[model samples]
Target chain A: MSAKSVQMVLYPDTHLDQAAETIHRLRQHGIDDRDISVISGVPYSDKILGRPMSWTRIGLIGLAGAVVGFAIATSLNFGTPYLYPIRVGGQPFFPIPTSIVVTFELTMLGLLISTFLGVFIETITPSYGPKGYSPKVSDGHIGVLFSCPTEKMDEVKKGLEDLKPEWVKNPEAKL
Target chain B: MAAETKTLSATHSASQEGEDLRQEHLMHDPKPREEMNGMVMEAMQTTSKKYWIALAIFGLGVLILLFGFWGNQIITGMGVTGKRRPVFWALYITTFVFWIGISHAGTFVSAILRVFKAEFRRPFTRAAELMTTFGLAAGALFPLIHLGRVWTFYWMIPYPNARWLWPNFRSPLVWDFLAITTYLLSSTIYLYLPLIPDLAMARDRSTGWRHSIYKLLALNWRGTEAEWHRLRKAINIFAFAIIPVMFSVHTIVSWDFAVSQTVGWHSTIFGPYFIIGAILSGVSAVVMILFIIQSTMKNMKYFIRLEVFDSLGKLVLIFSMAWAYFFFNEYLLHWYGGYQAVRDLLTFHAQGPTAWVWYTMLICNVAIPWLTLWNRKIRRTPLAMFIITTLVNVGMFAERYTIIPLTLGEQRFPFDWGAYSPRLTDISIVIGTFCLFIFLYLLASRLIPLIPVWEVQEGQMAHSTRKLGKGKVTSVAELE
Candidate 1:
């Protein structure tokens, strides 16, 4: 597969709204929102960008983890006593009060661990591969990394430049 | 504390360099995002000689007192220290509960403020979160140190041994262990999850070894919209879900004592009493640390402002009142019951040789907060808040001393009762742990961005001022 980053434009502080307009321009020019990316130092939600909300599997993963954690908690809490059934003052084999602690801990444990892993899995983090990233983005520049056709590259650059971005860079990625 | 800051700003305040007077607030006067990033990075990179000297002292203490003394105790049996008769719990347990109390503030301050969307929480969230992880580490250590046979500490695990006897499901120690482990893991993960974006930011601007380290930690984040969505969702889940877990951690820690048959420790009110007391101490510790950081660290004055100290002081005041209520509830119950053992314990706590310490504890924890924290000037004053919170911590330590050692030493049952004067080694070990906590925190500040610059930037994005009738007021747009 071959992909070329059409243009990278830097928008300063409040002029970040111009980046939104450029994103709108990209969409109007038949660029799929998925094909075009908005990169910035800070996180901006879909509302700010006027883009569709991105779906995430993190919540579902957390819910699944809670169920699994509860199951483990139940097994440990209920089944552990009988394994070593030496009577200690004739207490109940398994008490609900003690079991509640284990279950609660496990449930939260599962939620957090899964939510953490969900980030790595869903976001495909730790990706050291060649990405169309710019250093200026971290310096508070609002950058838009968009993909356009090989032939239409000039037109895309012209569109972004019209928004008066500080500078636009062309990128080449080969796989 | 406020006076020190007044002095510090006159002397130690980082070069404002033509910064607007209004820009003293982190929110109202926003710096260029790039400039803010530079400020944070510079703070991490630049370590003063005073910082290194403090670090060297803490580092030496950690190497010798924490590890060396602990190693010596591990070789010699548990007999070298103060554990004897009824007071077998002694300073170890006291310090354990103390560290655990300190842990609660970080989660309470960070998670509660985040859930409520209190904008002032922006700058100090990372600092408080760091305290949570490090404080738990310190708290977990006291238990291991308390176990004279430290190597076999894994015996507390629920798995069956060769005799096939598993850990008793009914033990509060097991519950405390579980809660601590769960909380440490949960809070550590919680701390790291949001730190990812900031780490990525650090990675973007660095080269050489620093770049490689940040690159690996950042998980190659590029701040894509999908990535941000998932990150935000996960952080939100942690924020809401972790609150109950935070409460459970401290409550279960209290159960370790409340479940016991000891005269003063066996109170049903211990759970809420411990929670309230924990918050009082925890919030105070946060203030103490924030005061130090704001005063000493480079460029921190711009982030940690008077409003932060003011809000935190308000929280300390509320927790102090709640603590008083819970303490009074326990006191009245024992007084009304007229049990001889309970009566003896109370008398010893109040009228014994340590009576002055007890009265000072009351004055510091209850009377002083009631009298002073209500004043806005005092609350806003960094120095005043520091003194008040420091006194509250002293009172809290005194409270622990009264509960654990004194109550255990002077018991109703004569056979199991004995005085527990801590050996110098025991005192050093506790001091070592304190130094280790500070050392770990000092090291963390250098590595991680203490302020979440991205979050601050996002906050700056959401926050703006608008004209309302005749005056301008700050308004924040809900970004999510």
Candidate 2:
């Protein structure tokens, strides 16, 4: 028979020091960092929690959007005027001063819109499927979610109970 | 024994002072996260009979005054409005600029303050951001209302057409369209980004239809480290990005007049002058709204403390001085140039039939803020700040009134000059926009978490009181 791993949760009150200690102890208990996730009502920096920093591509996406916006503005201002040329008061069809305004506005528009959409893309948002979650997290509690081999569940629970969490149980059953 | 008694007395006095400081500042006063969340949720959920009555009245005002008058204007044509000949842009343009200026309060208070790490901004940033989105909604309507034929407003969009006619990118009007559109979208997104975690909190606690709404709006936020990390990064990007965009928006709006050939309208100083004026009115509007929120909402007194009013009053006072400088610079240059038409316009502004507006602008924007805000007691007093901010906005409106119709009343040739006043439709539409803004705000106050609970909690976490040389002092940690 194959050994299966079970997801467990530990609820701690809103104390960064305590949460940090619990996470440190968990790491010492043979749990890899990738196998554990922390949820809380307030954001804690990775340094505060002694965890690895997470990276995001939102800035890159915003820059890409800016380039696209610049392209559109250039085409509209520089290229379209040639198609239906309407010369006014001996001014050039593509006036640099006026073109700058349109370019700046459009470029910003693209950057903002893409940055907003980037949040959704990066987070896989509007995801409605059931996942390992705890309502206590929103109530300003820190929830530590981790997986352990079914055979080792007893040992992990005993180890976590020493930390004095509110509860330690399988998240699937409680959530 | 005598020395021990003295030391105990001094220690007791220091602790008392520390306690008093906590009472005065929201950051120093820390509440449990659950309690703070409950207070915010209660504030959102609790509504009174007066609230509903006010909402209904504002809603009716919007329907009758805004939409009804606007619809009548559209059907009856532009003749019904006061726009005629040289004074073609009148009250509609003035109010349009006023509301756009009002929208700046949100970005200035929320984004700029966030970037600078102003601790007092924690509770009210959401309120100011809401003002940005709704103020833009109210302000963006005027250009369409001024369009005469509102249905064909899409012609301003840059798209391929059957006749190969594209909007003139060279025209300031087109820039106004682009700038306002970008600002509206950008501010709305900025408002929504900080709101997601709060929405998730609401979702977890709510039931029925409210739960469904928050669930969708929350975007299934789980408060995971990765999600929070990305959200913070995105919010930081927006914080820095939106400031220049905010400045650009009003600068473009100013160009609408500055680029014109009108003697009083053309000036290199208009851009910075308009920007300073906008910030003055914007910050004052924020103070006025904060007073309203603190007074009306439940449990808001705990969050919108007097310290916030004191800090914002300082900003208003500084901006007023800056505005005075620009006002003088613009006036002195025009007076020094000695151009006959420009001099006549300046004289007409002071001695015209509507000279009351010019005086009101001076007294309210300059005299009142200068005299009153310097007193810390008055600045800290909510009611006094409210009255002063309200007058400042009144003064700002008068300033715009002077610039638009009053200035347009003057010309190089006396024969071609004429005075302009808003007719009934124009007045109704202006009042309706105010009603529209209030109505949207009333609804939004109930629907969303007006006070950002997480941000307040985060701030409280970073703040602590420690003893420094036998005196207690509040210290803040750079948590981010």
Candidate 3:
């Protein structure tokens, strides 16, 4: 199946609400949900934009990191005697009470570092090439973009105009 | 205190008569967003001859005092710092505790208030968090410089080596390593996460290399609903986790002293004592920074108003009371037990050569704040609050100094007891750290929007005036 792609831009702040209305209008016209995109300066939630929640895989990754950290700590605490043993203060080589601190610290370190990595991975941050962007978004604006069949472009633009956007224009998404 | 209140109210009324200034000075005098933006931009762009002069002085201080002086100390060994027998932990440790205490305010303001949804906390949380990061950076240095054998510092880590000498995890020193590092990471992340949106704003507004830098930092954020949800969720987890982490970090730091077998250091109450001391010093540090930001930064005067100072003063007052309570508990318990060594230590702290420091700590930490903060007028006055808060910080510094070295100076064995006088190198390094903190803060203020705009707009949305019967009162709707 060959599908044609068409694009348009709306002034982010004034046109976002109308663009959202147009997306609803298009969904009724049988456009798939995946064809629509909304961008803004501040984080606009999925519920507000009528989209599904994006899941973060931070929890699984963080747990994995913690386990690895715990393993290293455990090995260090228990394996030290076989590696090189020395008695101190007439106590045994491995002290249970003292080992807890090392394990706890490493586990925490793992969880935190993984969480930091998770934010970047989940967000796919630092993408700097030209996509669909508008300056008004920074000034408390929101923009919505949707793809449609080339023949239906005028109809969709008309539908968007009826909802009273600030302005709408076709723009290329370079990269 | 009541008498002070009357005197202050009289002064307020007199000032009102002179200026005829209304409560509507900044809030009701609302300006356009564009104008406000220009004000902020201009503030950042505009530099005075005096600013350059001051920067030069601080810059020179940093060069000579921090690097040059620290190099001298490192070269001369720890001996140059006057850290002789029985006074092993001297000026460096005192500054460590002081800097660490200064750091707690940032997390307290940003995380604690963030947890409770305090509307007034909006504008200054970032400013306070910057304090936390910079203060922690400065605070971390004291320990490293104190180490003397700084190159072998990695031995503090618990990593297994060929020699297989396990790090003593039971020691509070090890805990300090873990806890402080955790705190630095957590606070830095917490500071950066909320800053992403603002960075995006700067990216949009800026040009050239600045724009490129901001674009990279802003990431590809488009404020999608899912993105907002994830960001909020991450922030929520951090906010909750960081508070306990903040508490534990200082408690563990307190353990550095409390775990010791020495007379004054062995108190069980040191944990709470240190926590209160941290809050006390931290809040004061916040007030000082807020005052500077408001007076010096352009549109900052609008954001950081009398209400903010009023709220901060109230915190200062409450923490002062808490500090007094902790001090009384610790002092009474020691005095009541009549242990000779503890009693002697207490006596020497009060009447020995360093007695002046004890009194100064009391005056700055307790008396001055207790006397002034009772008055709403004084609390509302930025200059008064700044002076009093500065005093509180000085007093807190003295408290730490007395706790560490002065107490260490008069231990059970008189044969080992000795006085500590900070050498020139010790003094310079301390001055350098202070300069470094202020220098970093200055740089940050220029580069970043010190006021969190989203948080401010959120607060403004929450706040409205409602009239009832004969009075109009401002009320806030809780918004997360």
Predicted structure with the largest DockQ when compared to the true one = 2
**Residue B32, candidate 1: how far off, in angstroms?**
0.4
**lDDT per prediction?**
0.84, 0.88, 0.78
Using TM-score as the measure, the top candidate is: 2
Per-candidate iRMSD: 2.1, 1.2, 3.1
lDDT of 2 by residue, B1-480 (tens): 999999999888877897899899888888877788889899999999999999999999999999999999999998998888778889999999999999998999999999999989999999999998999999999999998999989989998689897888888999999999999999999999999999988988888999999989998788888889889988998999999999999999999999998888899989889989999999999999899999999999999999999999999999999999999999999999999999988888898778889999999999999999999999999999999999999999999999988888787888889989789999999999999999999999999999888898889888988878866778899877
lDDT string, candidate 1, B85-145, tens digits: 7688889899999999999888888899999998888999989999999999998999899
lDDT of 1 by residue, A1-175 (tens): 5464555666875787898998898888888877777777777878888887778889999999999999988988887766766665857666788789989998989988998888878766443222466666777887777767677777877877767887555443210
Chain A vs. native, model 1, TM-score:
0.84
Each model's fraction of native contacts: 0.79, 0.71, 0.37
What order do you get sorting by DockQ, best first? 2, 1, 3
The better candidate by lDDT, 1 or 3, is 1
Instruction: Candidate 3: list runs displaced more than 4 Å.
Output: A1-23, A44-51, A63-67, A76-82, A89-94, A125-131, A168-175, B1-39, B160-162, B462-480
Each prediction's TM-score versus the true structure:
0.93, 0.97, 0.89
- What's candidate 3's i-RMS value? 3.1
lDDT of 2 at B278: 92
The list of candidate 2 runs beyond 4 A from truth reads: A1-14, A125-131, A168-175
lDDT of 1 at A144: 76
